[model samples]
Target chain A: MADLPERVEIAEEGPREGFQIEPGPIPTADKVALIDALSATGLRHIQVCSFVNPKLVPGWADAEAVAAGFSPRGGVRYAALWFNENGLKRALAFRDRLSITGSVSLSASDAFSVKNLNRDHAANLDAMRRMTAVHKAAGVPVTRVGVMAAFGCNYQGDILPEQVVRTVADGLAVAQEAGETIADVSLADTMGWATPTRIERGVGAVRERWPHLRIGLHLHDTRGLAVANAHAGLRLGVDRFDSTVGGLGGCPFAGQKGAAGNICTEELVLLCEEMGVRTGVDLDALIEVGRMAERIVGHALPSELLRAGSLDAFRRKQAA
Target chain B: MADLPERVEIAEEGPREGFQIEPGPIPTADKVALIDALSATGLRHIQVCSFVNPKLVPGWADAEAVAAGFSPRGGVRYAALWFNENGLKRALAFRDRLSITGSVSLSASDAFSVKNLNRDHAANLDAMRRMTAVHKAAGVPVTRVGVMAAFGCNYQGDILPEQVVRTVADGLAVAQEAGETIADVSLADTMGWATPTRIERGVGAVRERWPHLRIGLHLHDTRGLAVANAHAGLRLGVDRFDSTVGGLGGCPFAGQKGAAGNICTEELVLLCEEMGVRTGVDLDALIEVGRMAERIVGHALPSELLRAGSLDAFRRKQAA
Candidate 1:
């Protein structure tokens, strides 16, 4: 309890995550509407769109339109995702609207790196070095290191906490050689193989080694244990999370169909608020945004809170 | 980690919990099949069906047929749920196959008692007393005290740890007056108002007061924190749990439609098995049964593990 944070910083990835895999041209205006609705909630950070090849990810072909379309609210930092130089250039085009920072992204498992990026750890680090140069050229500060499959990998077996620590070190080394100071590390449960014990070990190991760096968990609910994993991270004082409203996204490569996406933002808020951890996000307002996201997706995403509603609503009704 | 139990006792309630709320006249044979399948999953205890009024709960009208239908396997303790003498009489008819131990079931919230059972706390106590007498007359051992709405209530606001402790004491007192030596208590998150912190506090309070009686948790996944709460209980060494296969039930009166039910059996097994705690149940076998449950229900159930497959499955594939 003493280790839990006073508040958590949630980066909403619903717009980027949902549109990336939803198998729709999902009208660009609806996407902007959902982002606008989310902006109205007290969420201070939102990822508005993904800048990727329109041919490969047809759902996100209108990424530029979504980036420019949504009404950005003051005090909220809007971000975008991109992989290479070309994608970064597209994202930079919206510098006035998007919070343009860069990340040194690497994978802990060599197999996941090969499968997801067609590169092993060595080759991925070289790519990160080049990406770091690109960010510097574009004047984007590279301040975060995201280690994918930091908990475990589906292609590889159980991931050791040491492996995660090593991966973070490798990413930090890449940034260090480029004169970039990494302030935080985000561990991605990219394949959803994380259990609470695994989280405690993984997060514990990283925090012990990098005592000054902020740690975040980017959890996927592929196995229905995301909230538990998040709770485990919170217990260890990991104060940053990446979530999707209504659990809006799915992993295209988790080796199974119907695999769940990120942990739902509203559920995480309820968990934090119930535990006396401040989230700075309005619970009811976020829930309403979750419902709106569900409508835009034209299907129910994986959030149970969207259906059952926040406990505060019932508390209010009961008080009445 | 030292406080976590090495092994746990899971009371399988899928057949009863699922059948009661599924809006089915879900064929008695199908219900029997699910029970028979669960029986083979290494789960020791299973609640087969609820003996309730037919008109009110048309789904469980064939409770007798379901009771007489399934083949009772060796070493398995099968149980049934009942609220009054008629329901108890119906269950006693199949005492040769069912485990007939009774429970003093009461709700911590008067508002929930009134809304759910048409009685306040005091009246509900009288009803529990009457039910206890009925159990004693039938020579049934009332060995467990169950406190529903033990964590929180929708009709009444948040339930405190002290309130839960008082409710447990009230139920234990009822059993004591009837000369029923209770050995264990089960606290239910009846309306799904529990978070991990609430769980720690409630479980902490009860364990503090009794110190000798065994404690278990019956968690609903409403609002999606059931698994996290279960994890919290595991941290405190609560070794008994009640779960439904495929997350196979819904809270009909959770003041909302499409509310999720109990913590998933396979998900619980995954959480325990991954944490080095032993849950004799096989993950692959349980996931298969969860699929079978989905087929019987004619829709997807809430267990994401059903779709994602077990981590062990991926491990085997990876190893291969």
Candidate 2:
């Protein structure tokens, strides 16, 4: 195997992406406690919540309350996801305390784009430009655009590499037109269709085209290839990844009835640590947080690491 | 990333390795039917059964019956596991019909060897030498010695690469003393403690010391790194792997009930195929066989592909 990177960044989005999908609302206090527990686990960045329509995703209705209830740690950076003008307005309310993250989603499947965002590529691009302007005015140094369905899609199967490249390029152009820098480009495998080959080729294409942009992967473990694809991205020198505690949060649009969720944070950390790639997160603590997440969500989780204790822990027990 | 091998050889050991640990006996006819189903799925090699004490592993009491009942396909090879004199005696009864495999266990933790095999290193080495002589006398072209617990053991925490190298060397010496050739040396991660770095380094060390011997991996998905470890092995150009259909079976010694089974055959195939490494097994047929195995086992299996369906199938549905 090739030499792995010295360290990789794991951006936890469980509170936002994970909680937003549940049909039942999670109490703001519980969300704060979960985020606080995750913060102590050595995660550097946490996407705290999403500023969105309460009517559409009532689960995230307590986003402002969650932000207000949570305690911010010294070293950790808290982020929030916002999609449009209204979401940005909500995000701006807590801009003093939160590092804002706005996504300009380019849905390869027009049907998904219309259903999820009620907008097509051109409309979303225009919204992205306006969002970039708002962030620029707010002096937010980095603007992140999530390329939703960057891989394949439920409605539109087999999203070509060119489509991703074009979407990313267009997204960047809009950001640049608004005189804002594209700080992070996240290739969101919204339906968990990001295969290793697809990941490697997509990352390679994006890297070749825009070498300076920080690339991140928002992968779903619906097909159980999330870690494998992450490794593929790591092979291509992509370091940042978005994962959720306990593999929480499913894409309602992914069409798999909650089986598709962000890759498990602890599992991803385990994979990285096993490969000799550093992921400064404390695995044991992260697993505790995963358990807390399972309890908060009122169901069993899909994290293999959470179920099967870490090898180190097992080894320590055997030694004792 | 390094170039993957043009193709990989998947040796299915579900019948022997997967069924042996089950408490209830799988009917001989069902075993034969499963093998027959696997045979038609384009799997080139299948480890049909083990010739061991039925009292110890009643699951395999029908080994002979399973072998006799199943119809072997034209392009497939059948193999069986043999431990000592008794197993060899049983295996030799059908020597013309099956390729025989034995294990030279190196339990980093001595307690595991005692619990699983009822022998220490020196005693197993003596048995290995005797087994090699028997195979040599029978003119078996290849003698395979699986290095059990080559990765780590439940009793013994971590097995170092040096220990694995030493075990392989000692096993080779025994085969050489018997005037026999060791055709294959498999590093068996019985407890699924193997990580990617360990796999690459271990495989690399084995390749460096004995370049001629074919190296294979017998990995378990206990810790969910089996596929990742397989990818790591692939990056080092190791092409042969042992997998079980529907991810059935578990190591009684693995201490996790049924969580640590041989890497799922369809999952492994999917990983390889997605990485552009060829596996001759027919995936759809294997998935159907996986469903059959699940039904025969009277429970839901852990195979992700079987649950999520294949990308091609999903794409076809979407296109339709």
Candidate 3:
């Protein structure tokens, strides 16, 4: 790869992460249209869908159909999230036009891992390692590995920095042994509990331990600190972020009652642009996508930019 | 008055500061119920309604009726905001149970003042002084004198710190001549263009100029930095804040089309509680009030706590 410019990549998550938490199934055609619209907004990396069991999460039941309909554009990467080897096989079917990615969540707290993913810490790590080996042999790129709940877990509360550092080292070691070079390593504030001070410490520790690994952030707006936390990460020189259009998606462990949404795409873009960081996404286009997502969900989504529109919207109203 | 605890007083603005922004008029009964609900949340100060010309702001046409409906309880001080002598006369009718407060807005740029208040900077200051004299002779306890647009005005662009300082000195000098001690001086970021560095500079300059005058903050969330700016003010030892419940208000100058709402009450409460500052407001009750406000508005309000409900809401869901 040529020297990557110092640009912040906003990894759009409307398909996999945003859809998973939705109560009812969104049709495959609508999902395709949503992804197609989002891709046209110049988002370089888009997580199209996840390869989980249809019975477990009905929202992504048509993941394969949705993936098949995606038209790859230049310099853009379409990816799907998978759990075990079966899911990995399903994702590998789109290898010609897309990059297949696998995720294993390691919670700093065991209770959260078991409660959320229905697996303890050791079992989850072991499954991830096996999947890594299968993907390596198939020559499909495993673009990312994320450590969810690396900050304080909702169930366990106050996850130590030492635990997160140890988990990153263990996951990196497993991936290396399987001959899979990790494209990116992300730390998620699974419950939106990480502060700027904690983020600085966590990101710093990860960088010191694995100098070659790229770091990204996956944040929730549970405490309304997601944007501030993302800005803090940027200040520390970490570029990539995971956001859902209209700030859709919530934790399953948090269940139906949880108010936490993904950090909003339009708001994130506005923040980046104001700070002089290049996100390569248009605010107006993202707002249009956000409104569509709101319609699909049958409820108003949590994005402020969509409701407020843009400064141009205000200017136009004045002109009228 | 007995020595009040050196506590930070955040006055809720759902009724007055918030309501005036709505383009269409909300029902008087709904307005009364909203204030009644907010009053029950244990906020020490609540700006209940504004006594502005009904022609200028149709939403506040029933200010006197709204004030009459409010029955003050222990420690809660219901207040009404007045812009000039006629508004103060309307405010004085509720003097038995409500405190009357006055506002003067200075534009760092002269154009904003003309556009927003229909006067230049000097004329606005003159109007404020005249209102102060009328307020003093009536023996109404003036809890606060607010200076709006203390930060940069949207029309003028950047406001000089020296302009802010001079405005404060002038307001203070008038209050002294009237023989009524100004309880506190509030600086508002009417547009949410303020950064932490600017906040620190503004606060530091104001403190150095008038060390004994109590200072407060009234911030907007136009750029998603209201909470961060509030935190900066708190770090500078500012104890009072003016916020609307559910973050209901926006600047008319931000224009009608794309204005952002005020900072949500739940987010502010969470930030303050986490920092160990006492806001003396009940979080659960405040969330309930936010929901009520949403119902009244016929659409969802911008409150984060209302959508997320409370931590208690999550705990209950987990229990189920």
Which regions of candidate 1 deviate over 4 angstroms? none
Q: Which candidate leads in TM-score?
A: 1
TM-score of chain A of each: 0.98, 0.95, 0.92
Worst 10 residues of 2 chain A by lDDT: A251-260
Q: Tell me how much of the true interface, by contacts, candidate 1 captures.
A: 0.84
Question: Fraction of the real A/B interface contacts present in each candidate?
Answer: 0.84, 0.38, 0.14
How many clashes (backbone atoms < 3 Å, residues ≥3 apart in a chain or on different chains) does model 2 have? 1
Query: Considering every candidate listed, which one attains the maximal lDDT?
Result: 1
Residue-level lDDT of model 3, residues B1-320, one tens digit each, is 01112356788887787778776678889888887888788788888888888887888888888889866787888887776778778878788878655544445556667888789878877776777777777766455556677876656655667877887777777677666676678888876656555677887898898898788888877756676577667767888888888888876664434456667776777666544577777888988888888787777666655655555454454457
- Docking quality band of candidate 3, CAPRI definitions: incorrect
Looking at model 2 chain B, report the run of 10 residues with the lowest lDDT sum: B101-110
> What CAPRI class is candidate 2?
acceptable
lDDT per residue (tens digit) for residues B217-246 in model 1? 999999999999999999999999999999
Q: Which ten residues in a row have the lowest lDDT in candidate 1 chain B?
A: B16-25
DockQ, per-model, please? Answer: 0.86, 0.42, 0.22
Model 1 TM-score, all chains together:
0.99
lDDT of each: 0.92, 0.80, 0.74
Report the CA-based lDDT of candidate 2 relative to the real structure: 0.80
